[model samples]
Target chain A: MSQIPFTDIVANLPASVPFVGPEQIERERGFTFRAKLGANESPFGPSPKARDAIQTAIEDSWEYPDATSVTLRQAIARHWDINTDNVLVGAGIDELLGNVVRMTVPPGGAVVTSNGAYPTFNYHVHGFGGTLHLVDYRDDHEDLDALAAKAQAVDARLVYLSNPDNPMGTRHTADAVADFRRRLPTDTLLVLDEAYSEFAPEGTNPPVDPSDTNLIRLRTFSKIYGLAALRVGYAIAHADAVTGLNKIRNHFGVNRVAQHAARAALEDQAYIDALKNEIERGKRAYAEIARRHGFTALPSFTNFVTIEVGGVARGDRLLKALQDRRVFIRKPGVPPLDRCIRVTVGPEDQRTIFEQAFAEAVQEVG
Target chain B: MSQIPFTDIVANLPASVPFVGPEQIERERGFTFRAKLGANESPFGPSPKARDAIQTAIEDSWEYPDATSVTLRQAIARHWDINTDNVLVGAGIDELLGNVVRMTVPPGGAVVTSNGAYPTFNYHVHGFGGTLHLVDYRDDHEDLDALAAKAQAVDARLVYLSNPDNPMGTRHTADAVADFRRRLPTDTLLVLDEAYSEFAPEGTNPPVDPSDTNLIRLRTFSKIYGLAALRVGYAIAHADAVTGLNKIRNHFGVNRVAQHAARAALEDQAYIDALKNEIERGKRAYAEIARRHGFTALPSFTNFVTIEVGGVARGDRLLKALQDRRVFIRKPGVPPLDRCIRVTVGPEDQRTIFEQAFAEAVQEVG
Candidate 1:
C-alpha cells in the first residue's frame, strides 16, 4: 500500500540529497584515506581541560541537560559582555541557520545570499519553501553590496553572508560588514555566519551589540575551539530574535557533554590562540604545495586554503585522482566558484601526505 | 526598531513556554536536592566501556561527525537484524519526535494523543500547527482504542502512543499493541514511543518488522542505556518512512562521542541486563515507600513509579513541599492524572531520601 500522505510542502519537495560520509567513501574505495583534510574542521583538537570535562561529564550523561542551556548561555554572554538573553545556544550553526530561516523566511518568501555561500543554509531555505535569490561572489569574497541589492530587489526577509567564507577562504573587513548591514532593509535579517570568524584577521568580526536587530552573528566551536563532532554553536542577536528562535528550536537539542566541554574550551583561550598559529602555518603549507604545483592558491583568513585548478574539468579530475590516491579534499559545487579544490588545514605529517597525493593526482590528470 | 519580521506562523505561535530548569529551581530554593529522582533518568549511568569510548573519542572531536551516522546505524541494524535503510539515528527521541511530526502533519491537521502523554510531542505538533485531539489515558496506559477512534473521527494524520508509558509507568500487552496497529487506518501513522521499552518485560516490545509502513518505533539510550545527556536515539521504520525523515533532519545531528558511546553501549548487553535488575529494585523501593505512606503507587512496567496523592490539589501541594525539602520529583501536568507525582527510580539512598521527603510533604500538606 502507498504510504500515508506527507505534508504538501515536504511531499512536493525532492528527497534530501543523500550525504556520503567519509566512512562510506572508504568502504566503497576499498581503502581508508591516508589524510583527512576535506571538511573544514579544526586540525588541532580541543583543549586537554575540555577533553577532561567530556570525560568527567560522562557519568552525568544519565541526567537531561538543562533545556535552557543556562550555564553555557551565561558563559557566552559573559564572553561577549552581553546579557544571557542575547545569546541562543543550538546544536550547531547548521541547526541555528535552519531556525533563523524558519523564523524569518515564510513559505514562498524571498531570501538572498551569495550563490555558493553555504549549501546547508540553502537547503534549509528550500526545505521551508523559501525562494532564494543569488548574488555571485566578488573575487571569491561575499559581495555584500550585491547581496543587499538583491535582498532589496526581492524584498527578501533574510540575507546570508559568510565572512571569511567557506569553500573559498576569504573575508571582508568588519567595517565593510557593518556598512552592508546598514544598507540592508531594516526588516530583513542578515545571517552573518562567522563559523571561521575566530581565524579571521583583526577587526573582521563586527563589534557585537545586544540591541543589534539588523543582524545575527553565528559562531561555532567547530573551527577554532575544535569541537566540530560535538555540535555546539551560538548566535548573538537581539533579545527578541533570540526569543523568536526559542519558539522553534528543540529545547534539549544540545547535549550535556558538549555544553560542559564547550564551556571548558571557552575558558582555554590559550589553546585557541596556539591552534590558530598552527592553523595559519598549515594554511601556508597548503599554499606552498599549490605554488610548487604551479597552481594559484587563494589568500585565506580561515582554516582552509582554496587552490585554483584552472577549470572545473581539471578540478573534478584532480579531486577524483586525489581520492583514488586516498587523499580527501573537496571543491565548490556551483560555478564561477567551481574551478578550485578546498583543502582544510592539517598537521605537518598530514600536509605532507596531501602534498604527495596532490603531486600524484596532478601527474595523472595532466 | 521592532524585531526583524518573523514568519506569520512563528509570530503567531505562542511565546515558547518559559522553561524553568531544575538548576534554576535549586538556585531559587537556595539548595541542591539531596535526591535527584526526577526527569525519569537512569541513575545507573552508562556502561564503563561506553565511557571509555567517550574519552577516546574526545581526541576525534576536531573532525565533523559522519553526517549519515553510518557505523552507529550499522550497529543498530545488526542488533535488530534489519536493513540499515530501516534505521535512522537522531540526537534524541525529542528531536526525532519533532522531525516525524514535521514530516507528516501539515498546518491545521489533527494529531491524536493521550491528554497526559509526552508533552514534547504535543509541543512539536502545536509548533507545526497541527490541531491536537486528546484521548484520556485508559487506567494511565495509552488508550490505543480511544486513540484509534479519535484518529478515525478527525481523519488524523498521526496518532501517538507510548507503550510502557511515561509519568504513570503503565503499559499495554504486545498482543494489544499489535492488534491496534492492525486496526489503525493505513493513512494515520502511529508514532510508537518505546523509550522505556528496554526496561519492559521480555515480551513487551512488539516484534519489529522492516516492512511496517503504518508505524515507526522510536527508542532511546537515555533510560536503561543511560546516555540521555549525549542525546542519541534511533527510529526503526519502513524504508520509505526513514527516507522521508532524511529529507529534513540535521545530517550531522548526532555528535561523535554519542556515536561511539552508543555503539559501545549497544554491544554491552550485560550492562543493560544489570541496569534492568537495578531499576526493578528501585521500582520495588518506590512501591514500599507508597505502602508506608498510605499512598497507592501505580503498578509500573518502566523504570519510574507514579504515587497517587489523592487529588490534583494535594498532588500539587506534595510536589511543592517535596521541592522545598530539597527532593526533586515531578508530577503530571494535566488533571485527573495530575493526582499523582511521578518519581524516577534512583539508588538505595536516593529512594530512602525520596521516601523521607515524600513523608514530610504529606504531613505538611495534610
Candidate 2:
C-alpha cells in the first residue's frame, strides 16, 4: 500500500526536538542529577496559593477548560493595564510562537532572528516553511540594528527578539528595544519575547503598546511565576493580532489547572518579589563560584548566569564533566556563546552543591 | 504603521471559533449552567488515582514536561499491545488532528469529512487552506462509504471518520470500517477518530494494524477516561506517520499533570469499566426521558444520546428554550442531524435536573 504523503514543508523537516528535558537526560543516564539547573527553569517552586489552586482544580478536570480563558486573560490585561482585547492566552509561549509563525509567515516567506537565540522559535519558523535570516549576536546581546536591517533587506514577515535573552542571560534596554522597533519596517511583525522579564530589573521591558500592530509581546508563567509544566503563556498585542491568533489557536489547549494556577500566581506579587530577591542572591553566589575558578560570569538580568569557560572545547568538556558528577547544566551550541555555560539560579542548598560540582568539573576538565 | 499582514490563507479565514464553550455561554448569559450537558464532558470526574497523580505532580510544575511524553506513550502502546514507535501523544486529539492536516494536506489540497461531523476538524482544514469535500451523514452515522468515494473523486489527501461519532452518538462496526478503508485510495490518509471507543461495545473499533501507513486511529482521555480538562490524547499509526508528527508537533505542549494523570487514569481499568456501566444506565434514562416527550433517542454507543426533536425548527426552538432554563446542551448544526438535540449522559443527580429542564423546554417550544 502507498504511504500517505507529507506536505512538502514537513517532508523535508528534521526529526530533532528543539530542546531535550532534564528528565530525558536522567532516563538515558540511568540516574537522577544532584542539581537540576539546565533549561533555565525556576529553582523556586510555584507559590503556595498557586499550588492550592492547582489541587482545587484537580477534581474539575472532567470539564473542558474555559475556551476563551476569560478570567486569566482579564487578569493579565489588568496586570499590564491593557484592554482585554489586546491579550491572548495559550498553552505557552512555544505554542503561541507557532501560531504567530503560522499567522504571518506563508510558505517561502522570510523571517529574522538572532543565531543561537531561542532555537524553539527558529524551529517553528522552519516548521512552517519560513526562510530564516539568522543575525549573529554582538557581544552576547542580540544585535537589534542588524536584525532590523536584515528584516528590511528581506522584507521579512516576522522578526523575533527576546529581551533578557536565553543562553547568555543578557538583555537590551527597553529604550534600545523601542528604538529597534522604530527602525524595523512598518509591516514586519516583531515578536518581542519577554519570557524572562519577571526576573529582569525594572525598565528592561518596554511599556505595553496596544496600538502597535507590528509588535506582539510574549510572557510566560514558566519563569518567575514558576509554572513551566502548566504551560500557560500570554501575548499582549494589538487587537488585530489577538483576533488573528483566535482564528486558528486551539481554543481549549490550555488546561483548567493552568488557568487557575496562573491566576493565583499572578495575584501573588509578594511571592514573585521574594523569589526575585532569592534569584539575585543565587546569581551572586554563582558569580562568586565562577570567580573562585578564575572565570568570568557574564552580566545577567535573567534567572541564569552564563559563565565564560575559557574556550569552546573547554566549555564542552566542563559541561560533560558536570553531568558525569551528577550535576545538570547546559552550554550554548553556537560559536561565541559556546564558550560559556548557562546555569540556573537555584536555592541556597542547590547552589552550594552546584558550586562544589562546578569546582570539581573545572579541575577535571583542566 | 501598517498592520502586520496575515498570511493570505489566514487573512481570508473567518474569525469564528469552532465551538462556543459552555463557560462562554454562561459568561454571556450572566449565570452558571444548571445542567451542563453541552460539551459532553464526563460528570463522573477523573479516576481517584488520576486525581492523586495530578496533586503529586503540582510540586514539579517548575519543570517542563518531558518533550517526548515517553512514559505515557509507552503506557498507551503497551495497553494496546502495539509497539511504542506507533504511538504519538498530544495535548488532545484536536491538536493531533491539526498536525495530521499539516502532515498531509498542503495548501489547496482536498480533504473529505462528513458534513457537521466535527466543526473543529473543519476549522483546522480551513485554517490550513485545504479545500473541504463534505459528504452528508447517512442515518445519523458518518457515511464512511460516501466519504471514501468523495476522497477518491477529489483525490483528497486526508479523510476524517469518527466511529461511535460525536454529536450523533452513532457508530459503525469494525468490519464495516475495514471495508471502507479498503475502498479508499492508497494515497489517502484515513483519520479514524475513535474518541468514544471506550464507551462503545466490543467489536466496534478495528484491531490495531500498525502496518497500515494510511490509517491513524485517535483516542482521547476526555470521554470515557473522564479527564477533559487535562487535555491528553494519542494516535496509533505507522512509525512513519509518527515520525512525521514528531517533526512538527509542539513537543512540550502536553502538560506534566496531564501526562501523569492520563497514565494513572489508563491504569485504573476498574474505574473505566464501572463508568461505562453507569453511562449505559444514564443512556437508558435519557431515552426514557425522550419517550416521555414523544421523541426518539437514537441508538447510541457513546457517552451522549441524540434525541430526535421532531424537526429542524423544533430542534432549534428546544435548544434555545433549554438554554433559557439554564440547561446547556447542543444540536447538530446541519440537516437532517439538526433535527436532534445531543445531551451528555450525566450522573443521576445531573440527569434528573436535565430531564426536568428538557421537559420544560419541549413543552415551551411546542
Q: What TM-score, to 2 decimals, does candidate 2 have? A: 0.99
- Model 1 segments more than 4 A misplaced: none
**Candidate 1 per-residue C-alpha lDDT over A1-366 given as tens digits, one digit per residue, 9 for 90 to 100:** 747568877887788653466777898878988888888887778898888889789879888888888899999998889999999999999899988987887789999988877888988888888998998988888888888888888988998889888879988999999899888886888899999888888899889986878689999988888899999999999988998889888988999999999999998898888888899888888888899889999999889999998999999999999999898888998888999999988889889999898999999999
lDDT of 2 by residue, A1-366 (tens): 597779999889989889877888899999999999997888689999999999899879999999899999999988989899999999999999999999999988999999999989999999999999999999999998899999999999999999989889999999999999989888999999999998888889998889999999999999889899989999999999999999999888999999999999999999999998899988998999999899999999999999998899999999899999888999898988899999999899989889889889888989
Q: Score candidate 1 by TM-score against the native.
A: 0.98
Clashing pairs in 2: none
Q: Write the per-residue lDDT of candidate 2 for residues B224-321, one digit (tens) a residue.
A: 88899989999999999999999999989999999999999999999998998999999999999999889999999999999998999999999899
Share of reference contacts kept by candidate 2:
0.87
In candidate 2 the C-alpha lDDT for residue B336 amounts to: 90
What does the lDDT read for residue A354 in candidate 2?
A: 92
Model 2: residues >4 Å from true position, as ranges? none
Residue B349 alpha-carbon offset, candidate 1, angstroms: 1.9
Q: What is the Å distance of residue B243 in model 1 from its true position? A: 0.5
